[model samples]
Target: MKSLKLISSAIAMLMCFVSMAQERTITGTVTDQSNVPLPGVQINIKGTKNYAQTNYDGNYSIQAKTGDALIFSFIGMDSQTIKVKSSSVINVALKESSNQLQEVVVVGYGESTSDYSTRSYDRAERKKAKTAATASVALQGKVAGVQVQNNAVYNPSQNVVIRGAASVSPKNEPMYIIDGVPAKANQMSKINPNDIKDLKVLKDAAATSIYGNKASNGVVVISTKNELYKNLTEQELDKKLNIMPIPSEPTQEDYDSFVENAFESPRTAPLSTFSIDVDNASYTNIRRFLNNGQQVPKDAVRVEEMVNFFKYTYPQPKNEHPFSINTELNDSPWNSKNQILKIGLQGKNIPTEDLPASNLVFLIDVSGSMSDANKLPLLKQSLKILVNELRQKDKVAIVVYAGAAGMVLPPTNGDEKQTIINALDQLQSGGSTAGGAGIELAYKIASENFIKGGNNRVILATDGDFNVGSSSNSDMEKLIEEKRKTGVFLTCLGYGMGNYKDSKLETLSDKGNGNYAYIDNIQEANRFLGKEFKGSMFAIAKDVKIQIEFNPKQVQAYRLIGYENRKLRPEDFKNDAIDAGELGSGHTVTALYEIIPTGVKSDYLAEQPDDLKYTKTETNSNNYSDELATIKFRYKKPDGDKSIEMVQVIENKAVALEKASDDMKFSSAVAWFGLKLRDSKLVSNKSSEDIKKLAKEGLSNDADGYKAEFIRLVEAVK
Candidate 1:
């Protein structure tokens, strides 16, 4: 009887073991680079519907047989497929997808591959072009859809447009992105083009969709390069040397000579021949001020006005890098006791050892529409400034479109400033506009002189009129879109008034993957071309995008300040190949958000019921410790094969706005400015005066004239 009982027990034990072996339970955890558990991860069999989702702890368990394949997938992460070759338990450490996370762009309502879309010039071409042109002049005629219009003179703020304008308002310019952040349009001039690596324009719906309603105009994505400090070793850092170049000063003799010469020259000129009354007035004034023979105050020469009007060379930033400053005292032509001051300010020397050569073409409009004093004349003046600043290695070409397109000047060395200036001086206005033909000719010239690893850009200046060949807006747009494939960039500058074609200009710039700007005056020109040259020309990042995930428990509602046109969908922020914006060197972008805390006691909303119908019955367990939002940024290097970056945001307890950092304060001020401009009803109890005060407090020590100008503009507008 004992033997029979033992046999039964053995049979039962064997059956239990067989059942357990047939269906084994496997459990494991998944984590990210920070070693933090990733919840809501999807786990499925290689070829079956059997799947399980990870919990908050990133832990998952499933019943499966040995030799099965387990697939793990998550948003903004690459998928992982693991084969169950041995043990039942599996743990996964997912490496973030560099391309997937960094290159994705928000095209209108959809998404596309940003990697495939080629603009006027590629990375190699831009590098080569950078070598040929001065750092300030790096981005001429290189982009297709962009239209760069040089104010016939050396004015800094040339007209820049993206994919043409779609609105009737004067503020139809495309949005600007700097270092993966959206900046105010007027502030675009603050960026230094020389520090940029690449520029990308989001023109078509496919490229601007992520921004939804605000993107109807267009979008620009800028990305800055990583600081070199990341790879520096402690010893190497300690050994780092700083060098600053000091210019020699003029001798006392030189100063005295200049003053003597200045005292001897005549200061006044005859009044305009057309001004009959001015002639009599001048005589009366001369006689009245003679003081028995005091020279009639130099006959009201307007010398001071003229002198003040001219942009005098100002001291540039002195740094250990390549930047330097120089000043000189010249012999004055009209004064004796007072010396004539001449300042020769120099910027950092950009070595061309690894820089690219460039082939640039200027597509100008010599049509009647551009006859405004602020139009053609201003353009001529602006171009002259650029011409004088060109380096020997750069080549420039001129193409005018009016009734027909013609090449006024073939590719020539930038050193021939006089020849270029003469050509600009001789241009005349007549006939209708032929923007299409002009664009074609400009592209052809740029391509003909194409230098490998150089920048090739076509700058178009116009009133956005294309009344001649392929005049239809759509036709011109298609042509630009196709021409961009040839690796050429386009920069559009809008001119004239009343009939200004903001829409067309916006389109050209956006599709060309370049930047756009509006030139309201000469000061604006200097700001664009002179002060922000580095940021305006070189692009360090392209197709950049930003997305923030707000934690519901920590915040009730949040509104992004500015960048109404740059907001992107959560999913579209990860797709590469979607055309975005470009970030220039040394450009700093700021953004702000006003959040309404969940537990705050306020009457901003309508009365609520005591008994909440859909409210949660349980309060958040760790509300104090949870984050409010996660800010994510993605960007590509000027010549890099992919994109990368880090993200940080505020999440702990809600801090008062008054206690925010300096960056936050400046960003909030900018937001206030945008709200005032747009007259947004969503703005809190903030005024322009309040914004100016906040901005003054947070102004950077290195602020050039931007802060002062901001304050002045605020007062003027108010």
Candidate 2:
């Protein structure tokens, strides 16, 4: 009788535990100390991979068992842990952390980045740490498990060991991941110390286990601030580096006509495809307009171009591909019912010494229209800097055209620098514009001196006024298309302003498989010719295109943020013969999409359609699935024929705007400004004050002072 009673009691206790184990969704709101809804708060069920971030309004619904603990964490906020009881709705209020935790590490890969217990060195502590310039410079007592012993003599890095390698063959240095790419010991010495943000040495197995065998010797993960904020403009870099432009009253300039794209329904058009655009001429042109205290014309603002103007330091690719891919999804700041999808592609940067030899042809338009000081004079100075950068093996040929095209200098070796400069200086401008002849002659000269497996290109410097034969935009495009087949690339450098044919030059560069840059002054020329030389010469990937497919079950309506001119038909994605923009070394491309998730009732999306009588209605595979969309990209090696594809699927990860990184927040501010310039309905209500505030907070390590310049621009506009 005692055994039966005991067994019955145990069975009742098991049933009670099972009753509480039923899985159910827990809806909640996350707030800050002041009761403000914290955006981007990451909430996850502890001891499990299930996680969700709080949306813009601090509302989040995630699946969890009644007995599980939920973790609520953000960057600067103190994390809160709570266990689920009978209540299905859990609201959490997290206080700000008085002391900064080491949570700013770049932890991707679906990992719960909210938690890192290891001690880390912030900017303050890093300023105190000292190391000699020699090999004996090791963190012996500084770090817990790391012991650096450099010989005062030979092999300086030989004694630097992290955790004393488990098995050593004399090469057990800790893996150094600088800016997302693994660096060899010799390469580590070259890294700029100013670029680093946080330095953390992962010595424990718990910290190093994430890297597997790569971490056997331990790991040194150094994170750098975004690249977009690091690049300095020409005028900013050197106040005296600009060409002196004669002060003339601001004149109106005409831009190519274009229309803003409209929102599209996923039910009718499920695929959004477009060619990648890296051109930033529009942004600089607008800046030029502003500098002259002139009102920018609405038509001159190309949102996509403006967004791509600044660099965004995305991660470098670790795979065989030449470019890295990164994406972020969040609620749109301007629209409550919409979400913003950000996609970034960064091309690998090739060092100047490693870049291939070049065969360059300078196509100068010495036409009568190019007589301005900012036009022909600036062009000559720019070419001189490029000539100085050429290697001994490189060759250059100069071709000029006014009434007719003719070669000013034959195929001259890069060593004969003075000869090239003399030829360039002798050139004079005073005839009818024959741009067609110039292009044809330039291509011929470039082709004649082409170097196999090398950088072969023609740099066209012009005011974009072509009045002779084949001057029509379509005709010039066709001519460029034919010449590009010869494996010769083009780079169009626009000069002057009023009467500048921006449309014609843009077309020529696009069809000729090249890049377009508008050099308004001498400082701008230095930026192109001196600082960004290799990036302009060496092509890494060509014909890069992006195709996004949003799950109809998750998304209701979507609109691409920009790239109105680069939009292509869905079928063109697979066609290899279709020419697209080329990605030069160290180039970064970014694209944004405004998406509306399903179940969120909004006036922007189309009405739900009834079941069709002629066909079966599409059904959701899983109504409650968290998948939002899948983005795929296709890119070809600079000289390869076949294209490679990479795909990434995004979850419904919505974080508060405050939780986003400075890279995301600042880029969004730039995108928001573009919309403001266009007067788009999307961000119409987003005031200049809101954008400036966000941008101020988004300034990370503005070491190069670009972010400061941008903030000044914002204040000027306001």
Candidate 3:
């Protein structure tokens, strides 16, 4: 009897194994019509909680009985139900719901449908139908509040912005995130649009709060394509992947041709029409001629004329990469009182993947003023270390601007290390700073040997002394501005202690469409060149600008802090030709504002005079009852023919600040820091300690020292 019972049990077990094998499993990716993989898509058995989250790759795998029903549901997509009949592999495409917000929108850490907004775009439903190849093209005018400006120039790195201007601070631009990492917004344009699977803008306070102070401006989230093939086998992944930089360097022949073309003036008149003498001694003589009440000729060495005369030497192109230039306009928002017009410009996009090839023009200020060890001598040693890292393709051109600018070396290649080192060794300190003359000569050399696509930039290492002839800040600015049009980017590397002229260096860099970095030591130089070289060279977007219209009803009063020079007039929004700030690849700009609701019990402002001209209109008590504010932005591509792109955000009830995404929290902390840095009068019940705590909590997976440095900076100021 026992043997018979055991035999029956064994047979039952065998039958169960067969049934399990027959059940089968269906697994695949879910994408929208545009072929963009959809994440957070709900997948479950009908009428059951047996659902799974879409992995980062927008793929899902599940076990199902032969006839079990599987349902797919997404925020803006129509629900899809399929029966697990026979096939073990299944791929699904979802159509957007026509009556509802048909497109799934990515917020900071969540997804939402356009149905939540009254002014959502109708054609967003078709975004998924197109492939990633044409994502930016498809985005032309389809997304409400989203703009894609194309440059007349055909270049890949297009400038993009989210929600218009929110502040007039130095870095009052939106934040950019890649794979959940807070990257620099300027760097995003360098990334191939094809490499991106999805890109979303976080506008309103609700969406941006995850980024906190930084979110006050807005946030852009870019999900790359690599995340989609997470589950594929190594072989399959290899077959589906082709990751390579699009060639951007020009050839040697191309460089020679360009040089030949440049030398041949198109004008029938003499080349003297565009030429001017700007040597330091000549400039000083001209100034002396003027100061002595002597008549100066039209051909006299004026500051502008002198600065424009010298040729700048860019590195010769070793590859097929094209050199580029970018610029931005600095104006107040439509409703502000500041009127300091400014423009920022940058040139070239040096690829980091290539060997360390750079034509570094060191504009050192060795005037009597730079007699300190931390000044001229320190500058020399600091630059020497940078030279040590160069490869054969790299080269260094030393231009000392003190009472005059002169090229220390014509164009020494990196391979001739000893020659370059010897030139540095032979340098000496003397004379006043003929900053104007030095700048002109440096640019002259840079332009003369202009590298077709190599990393050609003028690194101005100085203590900010421009005390010689035509040394005024404005004169220097004008000189840099005119030269920037010629495509030689500039980087102001500030050194020394007192009278550093931080503001002047900042302006030179801004006008030159480059960056200004304060280097107090070797570590700082390494951080700028060694660690952050990619951010320093590759400009993804130029002239990036943002504008925000606050719904008077939602926000009673608001104040933007820090950008005393970048505010734009309301009318500038309609003008697409204006120059603005540029964004480097992976560079992020953050802005902040402290807002006060209408009914909130806070001392925002003193009672205004009833007869005040601008306050004559009755204050609308009904405005802030249901709305907060709206944000808008406008920007141009690095090489686009025209400006394109606009984004908007409407404020909503505040969520749990702690529950906000890392972006929102970190952004807010940044805003707080900015406010403290400027000593903004708008801090509402917030303290420096609070900001620090919030920043610590929102710190993302920051392996680099960026966030930590910010935290430290904030603490130091406190």
Candidate 4:
């Protein structure tokens, strides 16, 4: 009987493993009965929060387990439900429904062709608003995450901004569509509340991407009960909507251009110096591009950021320092002849209750460009998550900027949770951005409420589109550089797309002695703000710099991956005035270097220069032939100014790729994938399949499922 029980337990364990492995990626296209692609079709996995929408090409990819049900829905189209089976691809064809065709309208992109509507209010629901003073007021309780702000003292008109929908313009107000004719926010109240038959709101990028720049603040489609337009056909509706074309605006998204690091002879340049980067924005931003079926721009693929996003098993610091250093050597997966070196830093983890008090100032951008669901709205949600994680000893203040900057809330104790949330909820996006003014005021507030030895920081959340006073990148950089001298660090949380200015945010974080992250979705907010609150909120070390000297005796040529923007002169490593990146509590940073051993012959090597006729090259004679490289780290305490240094030596031995640790393998895979994305000459022949296979080999300790997600992203690339 005991043996029988043991056999049953073994079978149960196998079943559990099978169930965990059953969750796989599902990809397909949504089309109409005529074989025309239907973009913005909302696909939801039944009984779960997992949801996705078709891109411009009507393509989508989602994750689900076997036997899961997926519901495909669109406006004016019959919704269909399908059960997941063994197949990974599920194409759906939605049929048009005449019954509800005239009752509602769906608008996407600029294609007059209706595809989907996220939220709608029919006549029955509209009746609830009949008692309200205006149509905008009626939508107060009807729409989710929608707020109607009325500055009665200044303006009588209600400023309606959707907190659930994201936009990328200075016009924070929603665009009004009256019977297919576009109208302005002021005209929203002019329309009689009783004349509306149906009202729908489009908030997601998939639904709004086609609407162009004018709709960046979101679009509200309304169908009036006018008998004159009651019997109009879909073609007539298109004609009426096309009366005014979407405003033409060039894409203002900005990313700094950088050339890949080229291999350098150790004999000529032995030291590689750079700041330690803790920012993981590039990885999440890259995932956003892949998930949307868009080609990632080469500038967006920061190899160091990608490799450092995941956590590794580095031991904690037992010494007086705030972080631990680790190193590993292994065969390069992409190039068999070359070797790869991994350097990792693990910041000491401190429990939230035990950490020092925090003095945080939420410097939010409520400009017109931040009106989108993902911008101001998502920003609010992300902040609320952090608020819940705050302790009573911590303190927070709120400052906002648009046309001007001012404090909305004074320094309040973290225990007043609801009060802080109420202030965040009341914020409305409008006017052009004055990021410089915002920074000035935020730093002032942080300094006033300084918690001597606590974590004092200004959290700036925005799309980085500063357009009003002092909006130039140079102006912002100088402003931030001055603010850092106050000993109050900065943290930039970027949101939205299209007009996103990554270059500006990066500069602010780098010069202000802080970290930067891009929040793409609510899930990302939870990941960066909720699960990793300690690391994202508190800092343990500041001005962290790394310098490594490769011995020519064991290494021929070497190149550091990424960090093109963070590189520093060898002399700057010891300069206390020189600013660098910060290491947050419990945060981990990883950097990789591709090295060519002394005997290896490769194409990457440049032609040798004239044999240096006057200078004879010297080889290491210190009897340290087994040492491949010596690395040095410099960092200052969170509140201290002077820097301390640490050193570690990497052995010359290289382990086989298959025998390397999961972290070494995973980091190598990430670096290779980043190189592949950038189309780097070093990895020109490497394919996506190669990245996927390498990533799979590093999935042993992925309890958080991030490693598995990385593999799926690799496979998603076309």
Which 10-residue window of candidate 3 scores lowest in summed lDDT? Answer: 252-261
TM-score of each: 0.48, 0.64, 0.47, 0.69
* Tens digit of per-residue lDDT, candidate 1, span 178-270: 555555442343334434443455766744566554555566554434432234443343233121222222111000000100001001110
As a TM-score, model 1 comes out at: 0.48
Per-residue lDDT for 1-718 in model 4, tens only? 9999999999999998797568676889999887878755778888875666675468776778888899887543667889988898999998764332232333344434332223222222111222224456545434565656442312334667666443321125677776676665655654555566666777657435756655655678766666334445544644543433332332677888999999999899979999999999999888877764467878988988898889999999999999999999999988889999999999999977789999999999999999775788678878988999988999999999999999999999999997898788677789989888999999999998888988999999999999888787888889899999888988999998879999999889889988889998777888898999889888999999999999998899999999989999999999999998999889999999999999888999998787777897787668878899999999999899899999888889899999999999888888888998998998645788888888888877787777887887786674
lDDT of 3 by residue, 1-718 (tens): 9999999999998887676557444678998887868755667787654654354357765656766788886544677888876677778888865543224354555763232211112322222322212233323334545543322122322234455534322233466666566654324544445466666777767555677765665666666667654444534433444323332221111000000001111111111111111111122223222322233332222222122111122222233322221111121221122111111112234455552356767788888877664566556666766676667877678888777778878778877876676676556678888888888888888877777656677888886767887666678778888988776778777765435555566568767867666565555566556665665555555556656554544444555443434455556654765556655543434444444444444454445335555533443566454444444445555445466654434434544454555554655565454444333444433466777787787677566655655565444333
365, model 2: CA deviation in Å?
Answer: 0.9
Error of 2 at 555 (Å): 1.6
> In candidate 2, how many Å is residue 394 off?
1.5
Q: Candidate 1: deviation at residue 667, Å?
A: 3.9
Stretches off by above 4 angstroms in model 2 are: 1-252, 606-624
Better of 3 and 4 by lDDT: 4
Worst 10 residues of 1 by lDDT: 270-279
Candidate 1 vs candidate 4: which has greater lDDT?
A: 4
- Best lDDT goes to which candidate? 4
> Candidate 3's C-alpha lDDT?
0.52
Between prediction 1 and prediction 2, the one with superior TM-score is 2
Indicate the worst ten consecutive residues by lDDT in candidate 2: 120-129
Ranking by lDDT: 4, 2, 3, 1
